[model samples]
Target: MTTYKESGVDIAAGEEAVKKIKNDVKKTFNKNVLLDIGGFGGAFNFPVNEYKKPILVSSVDGVGTKLKIAFLSNVHDTIGQCLVNHCTNDILVLGAKPLFFLDYFATDQLKTDVFQSVVKGLTKACIENDCALIGGETAEMPGFYKKDEYDISGTVVGVLDKKNLLSNRQVQKGDILIGLESTGLHTNGYSLARNVLLNKFKIDDYIEDLGCTVAESLLAIHKSYLQPLLPIINNENLHALSHVTGGGIIANTLRVIDKKNEIFIDWDSWERPPIFKLIQDIGNVPEYDMRESMNLGIGMIMIVDSNNLSFFENHLNSVNQSYKIIGNIK
Candidate 1:
């Protein structure tokens, strides 16, 4: 008789992983969490009384080829955090407060240490965002992944008061575009980054421009915009937000913009990070392609009323966060 273990799925290890992560996951829970791990479905106590009208916003995302960097560096922990933060930022742009998160991890061989690290990262992000790690799945399929390699994806659910939703409907011709700085690549453009660094230039030959090893430059963690933008969510003139991701600044920003208004981005307004410059120099990538494929140092863009530009600028300055008036809606 054939058994499940023969097909490469390790039920035992999965159970062990659940046991291992339970404490770590529980640490992120608050009054809202209703169910613990190892259930058919996870549950949360919705605080419906807290808002006049509450809308639940959700987003799911992975780390993309940034996973390849984690695999290469044998650094599995931060990718999970990156995945959670990336998803959190997506809904934060919509003025949502994250409620809970669920993760999906698949691998051929589930190394206990690596798996724990991944869960720990997820736990950390959930705690930081004031969200609970409700539940998740860990699939061990020997043939689905190469040895020591795994993939991660996460789902985040958040709540927003109906009146507070930043739907981009308020975006108009006079709105000012404020560009928020990114730590580095922040989980996009990695496939192109790897091709440029590994395929074009040898790591041993450090380029004078980047000032770091290619691997170090490529493995920068995808940052969360939560702390920086959360305090400003209630500003009446804040029209919309765009999280710069796979489609880059233009396409992503356009998703939240109306067709009648055109967004004019001043490319020269912000300083391009040296790492991006190095990638461009090595690959000779086209300007349009670069703009479309990468964040180009601006990870998140906030659209605000032109009249409140100075107020927003002063607020951002008080936080000691660098920003620039990248452009305007026309």
Candidate 2:
């Protein structure tokens, strides 16, 4: 007979971690979560009455090498938030309202306290978005990861009315492209960042330009666009939306554009954040590669009717949110 412990995966430790996080996760629960945490599968009680034709939207994502920054800084908490928000925003671009989230954590060893901190971040994000923490998996695989290293991924389920679903098919020529400013790197291009910065300067070394340690700048939490986009999603003038991620602004924005219409971005329209400038200056990374690899400063892009441009600008300004008219479709 094969034993789980002999296979290098400790079922007992995984169980203990679950037991520790069950109550804390429950704090993010809403009426939609019908099942408890330890079940064979998660159960979410969909609000059938809430929609005439409810369509479920789901997305899964990982923190990528941003996890390395978390491990290096000994800050495991916010990575969970990053995972949840990233997944949530992925579906939000389709005009979905998040319902619940599930997470998967895998590591070579189990550290209960560190895992708890990660769960706390997830819980906090779920509460802020009014979503539930339904269920998740915690795996301990001794050979699969380094002793102190772990990775986190999450799945978010959301709802949209069949009539309200947003797709790239709606994108058209003459639509205006608006960009929401990012709060630093927002969880991509870390491998390149680490390769350049770690070779030249220690994490503790303060740069006068950045006014802080390089590690602090690299570890900034990925910002969520849900709050700012929510108010305008129902507006018919909104043509298409894109959430800038690993492929940077061009690739991500193009994903939601119809092939017939080309997107023209004015590179000089927005201010590039200092962290990106630091990486570019030190690494001598080319401008084209920089545009293809990192967000540069814009984390999300909205494709809206030119007629609605003023309305969008007013709403963003009312929230004290900074944005730029990066380009338009032609």
Question: All predictions: root-mean-square deviation over Cα?
Answer: 1.8, 1.8
lDDT of 2 by residue, 1-330 (tens): 988788787778888888999888999988778888999888988899989988999999998898887787787888888888888889989999899999998889888899999999999889888889998888887888997899889999999888778883388889999999988888788888888888899877888899888878887778888888888787888888899998889899888987787989999998899999999999999998788889999999999999879999999999877899999999
Cα lDDT tens digits for candidate 1, 217-268 = 7766778888878888978799999999999998999989898889899999
TM-score of 1: 0.95
Worst 10 residues of 2 by lDDT: 163-172
How much is the lDDT of residue 4 in candidate 2? 76
Clashing pairs in 2: none
Q: Can you tell me which runs of candidate 2 are displaced by over 4 Å?
A: 1-8
Error of 1 at 324 (Å): 1.5
